[model samples]
Target: MSGVVLNDVIKKYGETQVIHGIDLQIENGEFCVFVGPSGCGKSTLLRMVAGLEETTDGAIRIGQRDVTRMDPAERGVAMVFQTYALYPHMTVEENMGFGLKMNGHAKREIQTKVAEASRILQLDDYLKRKPAALSGGQRQRVSIGRAIVRGPEVFLFDEPLSNLDAELRVEMRVEIARLHKDIGATMIYVTHDQVEAMTLADKIVVLRAGRIEQVGAPMDLYRDPDNQFVAGFIGSPSMNFVRGTVTDGGQVDVPGIGTVPAAGLDAGREVVVGMRPEHITIDPAGDTHRVDLSESLGGVSYVHLLGGNDKIVVEERGDYRSKEGDTVAIRPDPAYLYFFDAASGQRLR
Candidate 1:
């Protein structure tokens, strides 16, 4: 296994440039995830590292060797795409070993590697079954097994579980994480799913508009986001933003909600107050807002409230339930509040 390094990488298509200058380093054996909204260049960046897409400028290095100009086969990386891409006529065992066979390995060598991969992926019983006989998860495991057989230095996954059902996606996520731990291989996974990135990555790279927004551990990005985009994108329920203004005593006054501390700001400066639903405390006794909707999901309930033109969701657990049209008040935890520049969406310290 080897590390990957990108120095000022850029990608362009004819006259239109898509990926801007990107500098990144993936340590050997690190599991890095590239994540963002759709068409944000996450897949394109992964392809650049895999030698599938042409790099418009800058250099790509794998281990100690420069691989920017290297062929896809010579880059020593294995890519598992969203589609299974397995041969229909071949059995699972044949499919897993086909790459080795094509590479001119002896039959015994292919069988040995295939057996090892099957053991890792728990495909011993399904080895004789064809693609038609296997489940979607099993076929993907076989696809992954083929990559393991090649012994690539870096493993690239392009939304490999997108086709699976929710349960299967979760199951495969555990399996993939375990595979990385057991093999200690360097891996780069691309996905639009922030949940997957949070659960699987040792390092998460957040990208937007052909550039990196932030890079850190999943929880680091969640807790200390540098901007409004990172804060809203990293969390599952997304952060809520409300208009606020700095007051005479350095406090921010939220129109519908009460005043909170801003400490140091010009008297009339505009700021966006951010609050997470989970951190808000709902006071049913106080009539500041009205419940617009309530979605009960077993142990947790999301209550949407409306006050004038402002709308916010509050997560509740325990005995209290806020039905539609019920009067309520919400107090966001002062320590948990984040303030951002209204004009630029930049986090304000």
Candidate 2:
């Protein structure tokens, strides 16, 4: 019953609206991630849920209680920010218990809560250590432990890993995922990195330009995207697109490559054909493709090709590395092909 529900929620600054009408539901104990590029209103929407931003229209319900106008502390949620925001003057234990002390909690009660949080985060050994004595990952874990001690109904994270180095970011990602599994609390995380969203979230909310583009399970959105934008945004290296025109025989003819069978589309219509890099293979017998560059990553390689006027990327494994300026024919798997309208970018089928 502690699930979150947004009924046509909206936000505006002055005369300009940032968040469009958005309706969403997040179940209790679910880890949902909001992911999109910069200036996409993902953070804005998250702030509204945190009660840090006012709703220009509609209502926000948390655990069946209306909290649209509630104070941040009254919303039954704890937020972790990109910055650790720890107290340098205090030890980890003191910093974790400071909030409860200020709230008039008894000394023994505060100590008990801090001890439990420290144990859960494996910071028991560092309880007496100051912020300066801890590493970046350890400090971030302390920040999370602070939230855990509060025992909020919902947990909100806003780009919490952005401040860490690449290696620490990966480590923190695993830590946070494991924490979610242990706590089983309703959590909402926001990040611009789709890879984090894919790996950490039970459900993902993809946003763009102040509007939600799509929402679904990670693999569901990856395997069956609703539009070109979602398909292009969800995957690493992105999906390749080439302009084409539909033919009379239910096929789409790319200007540089041959025709591809795409049933269920009208003839003579302008469209864009999409394919993933993994679905493309080099055809040694064909002569219309040229390898522009090859990126070797040990077990896998990505070969960038120039076919006619289009640039396509193909993934190769083992001994299929093609050098720059090498002539190669690249073919896409028709079974995995995607088609979209030229004007609207909507999926054709």
Candidate 3:
């Protein structure tokens, strides 16, 4: 296994700069995922590390070697792209062994590597088939197997599962996770899917507009986000942000929900209160609002309430009897509530 280090990396296209100075250290055998929206430089960063794109400044080190200016083949890294870049004419076995063949490895060694990779990826049964004969997931596995046969010190994936169907994506995700465990190689993956980043990564680097927003374990970012952006981006259904002004008695007065005690906040300061949908519950005896909609999802139901002028979603356990236009009292758990500075969007204690 090999660790990758990027020191103050920068990329520029003539006068237009895309990637700001980025410094990141990916540890050996760790699964680090880069997640962000489209045109956020996630793919550009991955390509830079793979030697496909040149870095305008700074250095890139894979293991102990400085490979900033090295050719793609010279670097001990294998990349799996979004499109299954398999040769249509070649059989699965041939495609998997092609890298080793080009590098002039012994025929027996190439065969052994291909067989091992195929077994690991569960592609053993389709070795003689061409790319067209394989399913989308199977073909993606072949693409991964091709990388594995090269015995790269590090593996880089650029949205390798985006082409597959939803079910196939899940299946491939499990396969990729298992493959990481079995191979024990350092892998860096780039994707826009939060679920993928949360499930597959040992560490996640969240980026925004050419700069990193936050980097930490999935739960760390989810539970204690540094700012509103990280808080809103990391959670499913997203965290709800209610705009309110801090009151004189150390409380935030929502337009219709009345004053919520702001224990640690200074009085008379404007702030945005954030709470996850799942953290809010329906309280029958408390202040109530008319429910606009209720979506039942087996184990839990989400109740959307019209809180005066604001809309609040409450997650209730089991079946909820609330219906449209029915008033239901709802309250947010204090412990899960977060505060952010209204102007800067930074988290406040």
The best candidate in terms of TM-score: 1
lDDT string, candidate 2, 218-254, tens digits: 9999989989999999988789999999999999999
What TM-score, over all chains together, does every model reach?
A: 0.98, 0.97, 0.95
Residue range 1-349, candidate 3, lDDT tens digits: 7999999999999999899999999999999999989999999999999999999999999999999999999999999999998999999999999888998999999999999999999888999999999999999999999999989999999999999999999999999999999999999999999999999999999998899889999999999998999998897777988888887788898765667778867777889889899887776655458888988887877778887657787777864456677776767777888999999999997
Candidate 1: residue 7 lDDT (0-100): 97
lDDT comparing candidate 1 with the true structure: 0.94
TM-score of 2: 0.97
Candidate 2, residue 184: CA error in Å? 0.2
Residue 5 shift from truth in candidate 1, angstroms? 0.8
Task: State how far residue 280 of model 2 sits from its true place (Å).
Answer: 1.0
Q: What is the model-wide C-alpha lDDT for candidate 2?
A: 0.91
Q: How many clashes in candidate 3?
A: 0
Off by over 4 Å in 3: 284-288
Worst 10 residues of 2 by lDDT: 283-292
Backbone clashes in model 2, listed as residue pairs: none
Query: What are the lDDT figures for the candidates, one per model?
Result: 0.94, 0.91, 0.90
